[model samples]
Target: MNTFRAARFALRAKPTASFLGRRTYADAAGPSDKIRLSLTMPHQAIFKGTDVVQVNIPAETGDMGVLANHVPSVEQLRPGLVEIIEEAGSTRQYFVSGGFAVVQPNSQLSVNAVEAYTLDEFSIEAARAQLAESQKIASGQGSEADIAEAKIEVEVLESLIAALK
Candidate 1:
């Protein structure tokens, strides 16, 4: 009976949405009406009741911002900043690197990354270190592959730093 119960529990247990190995959020943020996000780790977020908003992202071409119910599309994100409308009707921003964002017109959104968090979680000290490292690599002109890697890292780090209040 005990073994059977354990098996049942395992089958019914909820999965976790983690970032870079660290558990990001068992349930990162609550659902909303305007936008609903589904993560791979088995979590969902909703941005309901948002009419107009902004989403800043580092795109393959460059940085771009999207508005509410803009359109159904997908983009390869770069390391950079993202902006959104807070529930309080204020601007909310975050740092994202090496991820893709999905958009829908009627009300849909999904952003997946190696790691992601709010601006509140960023630290100044961490940003400085990353900036220094990125600058060093940029000066070297290391290689196309290396430059791309460095650019992505720098972008993500910068995004984190910008979130620092």
Candidate 2:
């Protein structure tokens, strides 16, 4: 059985070079390349120079996808989900409050958000309750500043609900 297992492992192994069991820099930026992504929030860095196949972000202009060698540009993000496609064909999604996404030269992407978390981290019941409260405050005869803050809260909660779907 041990010999059979060793043979199976040998058959599954490839000749590609790896570093610490991770893909090498050359592999990440090879001819069939991936973009290096840096997704940062105020309190945490979700992705720190990680290589990915594509990234879909909700920008104020519109929803956009960034791929390797994409044009360098800056986009103001809206409160929504950011999807990251990795080299292994797995995808990660994060809900960001709002911020900026900058596609730098040499296939580098940087996203700085006010807050971010995975969709599973959110409680839909809590969001719905808050949304209802925000709506009430935004529509009521509250102070201008209070109404404005409530409106913003409503917008963010609505977006989060939409993303959860």
Candidate 3:
């Protein structure tokens, strides 16, 4: 019984380095060569002068975007959408209901969002419904705080729907 340590898949600038992890590799880049990304756990990473992203839930507020060249920002991220444009030009979108993003220019992006889900796995209809519902809540009897939160929800759902395409 071989207990696997990690399964990493990195998309290099070209098509050369693909997947790298474990011993039994099936691609040209499978944990064999030295790839730039060192990721642990799915859809997240620690600050190794690299990028970090995350997602989660709670229906707190809205969505945010954090890029590598983001000017070292600090903000309280409300749940919604997290778009990741890899160095390889590949875009990976996530839905985050609540969390925050810490960014640095040409360096890294650290995202900690509550309840994040990949846009590729997102449901458009569901997102649309959520958007509509949140909009209503935000516009209806929500307090200032509630409205702010609903706005975040709407943004996140809308962003997810857009990214899925």
The per-prediction tally of clashing pairs is: 11, 0, 24
Q: Tens digits of per-residue lDDT for model 1 on 1-165?
A: 685455333322332222112221122322322344432212423333334334556667566554433335677877666666544678766565567877654445566666556666767887888888986786676998888877766766665666574
Mind giving the per-residue lDDT tens digits that candidate 3 earns over 1-165? 122222211111112222222233222322222222222224655323443332221223333332222223444665455554454556555566555554333324455653666666767788788888998998998689999989877776765666666
User: Worst lDDT window (10 residues) for model 2?
Assistant: 15-24
Off by over 4 Å in 1: 1-33, 37-54, 62-65, 137-148, 158-165
- Models, CA RMSD each: 15.5, 13.1, 13.3
> For model 3, how many clashes?
24
Q: Estimate the TM-score of every prediction.
A: 0.53, 0.80, 0.43
Question: Candidate 3 regions off by >4 Å?
Answer: 1-71, 78-81, 87-89, 104-108, 136-152
Q: Provide the lDDT at 28 for model 1.
A: 30
Q: Local distance difference test, per candidate?
A: 0.54, 0.81, 0.46
The candidate maximizing TM-score is 2
Best by lDDT: 2
